[model samples]
Target: MRRALHKWGAAVVVAAGLASGGLVPNAIARTPENPSRVPPVALVTLPPEAQATHKLILAGGPFPYSKDGTVFGNRERLLPLNPRGYYREYTVKTPGLRHRGARRIVCGGTPPTKPDTCYYTSDHYASFQRIAP
Candidate 1:
């Protein structure tokens, strides 16, 4: 019985991961209606630079980068679907980088400063994890 449960348990784990929108290693799973529900990253857990960037976002930044508060195309589609201009991107300062690094904060909503949701990406938009309020 133990061996039987172990054999079936792998499938159960994968199923549970899918149901909870968690990634199953080496598996490709996504749909237009169900874009990947990326995991959430706690506000306090973020790097100091990211934390500062988040504050700047809420404070209506006088951002360092010219493109800090520009529209994020979301071309990678890793983020949840939103119409054009619904998302905006801001830079997260990366130490030792002369130019803007991969780290960024992408917020979605109107008025820019007051966003409905925010996400953080360290991989140049290749992936994003929602920033938990």
Candidate 2:
């Protein structure tokens, strides 16, 4: 059963990767319009809000909130399987919210000045969608 689950998960990631480029468009709302066609939750492509977060992360921001560039312990193991401290998470501002929302940009690499790749998770750490700048 575990092996089966792993394969299923692998399939989902592959689907998301294919959709990462242009399978889903900018205006594609993330509703269950077509479950089969819908990209994996982790790789649902970047939304405008997430895109903004990506920009800020790359800019080395004076982040709106304090806990922006803290080391992200990938306790959930939902990411690309990196070691602790290898990933640092940044808050993605949710408009009209007093506190940090569930959205975040988890980047992996060195120096924090530059990262190899980054992923966005609108639903916190439940899932991650890769983004490229």
Report lDDT (CA) for all predictions: 0.79, 0.65
Candidate 2's C-alpha runs over 4 A off are 1-45
Which regions of candidate 1 deviate over 4 angstroms?
Answer: 1-28
- Residue lDDT tens for model 1, 30-54: 4445556688999999999999999
Query: Each prediction's Cα RMSD?
Result: 9.3, 10.4
Alpha-carbon TM-score of each model against the true structure: 0.78, 0.63
Clashing residue pairs in candidate 2 are 42-129
Q: lDDT, candidate 2, residue 85?
A: 90
Worst 10-residue lDDT window, candidate 1: 1-10
> Over the full model, what C-alpha lDDT does candidate 2 score relative to the true structure?
0.65
lDDT of 2 by residue, 1-133 (tens): 1111232232222222233453323432222222122224333356667767677777888677789899998765556555779999988878898889899988889978689877777798766666644
TM-score of 1: 0.78
Minimal lDDT window, size 10, model 2: 29-38
lDDT of 1 at 77: 63
